[model samples]
Target: MRILIVGGGVLGTLHAWQAVERGHDVVQLESEPEARGASVRNFGLVWVGGRATGAELDTALRARVLWERIGERVPGLGFRANGSLTVVRTEAELAVAAEVAAGAEAADRGYKLLDVAETKKLNPALRGDFRSALWCERDAAVEPRVAQPALRAELARSGRYTWKPGREVRHLSATGVVDDRGERHDGDVVVFCTGAWTGGLVRELAGEPPVRKVRLQMAQTEPLGEELTTSVADGDSFRYYPAYRGPALETLEAGQPQSKVAQEHRMQLLLVQRLDGSLTIGDTHEYDQPFAFDVTEDPYEHLAEVAGALLGRPLPRIRRRWAGVYAQTTDTGRIVHRERVADNALLVTGPGGRGMTCSPAIAEDTAEELNL
Candidate 1:
């Protein structure tokens, strides 16, 4: 089978990877020279700890396995099972962590309530004043900036995968697709993994998917002198992830509301160090469209303060700051929005922030469903 995958982001590249691995030919097209969307501009967290129970968690676990296997095959991925630490400062936050650690599926999620000593042992860089932390051993990280190129290079070696950049799909058909160059690429099946791009042919074909765009602001700093063994998040992250929701979380939210700036930006502090030792930190959520043309400094200020509080030191000089947008489903219950627009054409998108964590498993499911 010849699979034509539109969009060269992680999701589409993973689809190509899956098809080519199954001994099928694949051709993927990207509008720009390479993907410049939410795919590359993310924390590269293969996060399993914060995923909601059931299907979302299951997909994250499966994708984690796939990522390990693929990362072993491609060393450039920079995959590591470093896990994560959500540090808590107050008694309310500690209660929430305890609740999550005591949940029925806590074992599956690798949830452990760690004291100050145990937390410091896992990530010695954290010298801050915190009561305890929520440890998730199943979490991991990857190099999002280079993952696609690395995967495509491996797929190219298969001799059945072709990557065509600077080409956008202008029209779709049951048999294949037509690019902006007016060239027709034929295939037995066509899968559109377009991420956050809901305009042009996507709107024409799908007619306003059950998904919306989400904007976020992030920044990276100069290399830290020391190693940050594990990814770090503050207790505020409990407000963003569904897995932490419960009576305890509800009480924490009521008692300890977010800061004025944090509430204004819908912010959460997630910090991860890159292979070069630089820390990638972010982010604040913006749901309403027509996102700001300029990135604000208040959120970054808040992030720095929170991060400094966790590490017991000031952050390194910030080198870069940017904003990105991704597609998310309106219905929070659905993992992603997958629909068949034609007999041989299917649209799979709106994995939201889970694009990095769940792409591999999502593509695997797509293959099994289409019998490709």
Candidate 2:
């Protein structure tokens, strides 16, 4: 089968990788010269501990294994098992941490609640006054700058897939795609992994409902000079990810909003000290339609303040600041849709913000769905 996959985000790359691995001739096209959307702009977390404790939880668990398997199957992918530390600063935050631990237990996820001393022991960077931490041993992190391109290189090296790096696909058909250059390459199937750009492509393909893009703002700090055992965040970050939100969303929705920590917002601080000394800290979600991306300095200041409060260490240097965008679902979950007329015309998107950690397994399933 000759498959033409549109949009070379994480999911697009996954589709191409799996289809090629399964003996299909796959061709992946992207609008940007490189990945310009949320895939490259995230904290690169392969979350295993924070997903809702049912099918979503189960899938995330399997997804963790998938992240590991990729490293094994294709070496140098840079997938790391650094784990993650979710901290608690207040009684309410501690309750939320306990809530997550309970969900992990019910879902048979291997996680342990860390007391104050234990939390400090796990991450020496943790500071301020914190009550507890939920440690999920299997959860991991990766460097997207290394991993995504590595996967793309692996697929290209296999020679089973024809990768067109700068090809901007303007139109898609059950057969193949018509490139921006007025070139058409017929194929057996078409899959759109456009991420935030899915809305436009959906209308072009005349598909159901639609996919939307949400902007995420993040910042990276200079070398922290310490090895972080895992990615870390608090209850504020948990509520944003549906997997972490769990079955208590209704309760959470009704919960009163706390006083503004700063800037009229109170998101928990998230941190992942990469293999490099630099700590990858982030992120605040500011949902917008077609054009809602502005990487301002205010979010960075707020992030540093929160991180300082959590890590108990003043960041001396902020080497970089940036933004990311990902596909969002009305239901706030990943959407994997198929057009009724063409079984091969599949739309793999709606990851919201968890695409990095979740796409590996999803890509495997996508290949299966395409029967490649």
Model 1 worst lDDT run, 10 consecutive residues: 328-337
Candidate 1 on 195-290: residue-level lDDT in tens?
999889988888999999999999999999999999999999999998999999999989898999999999999999999999999999999878
Candidate 2 regions off by >4 Å? 103-107, 199-201, 243-256, 259-266, 288-293, 332-344
The TM-score that candidate 1 achieves is 0.99
Largest TM-score belongs to which candidate? Answer: 1
| Overall lDDT per candidate, in order of appearance | 0.94, 0.71
Tell me how candidate 1 scores on lDDT: 0.94
lDDT of 2 by residue, 1-372 (tens): 888888777878877877877888887888788887788788878877766555566667778887787888766677788777777666666666677677536336667778989888877778677778878787788777777678887887877777676877776666677887988978888887877664565665655445566666677788887766678886576566655564454465467463354324335467877667788777765554554445667667777877777777786488888877676666534334334335557777777656786786777877776556
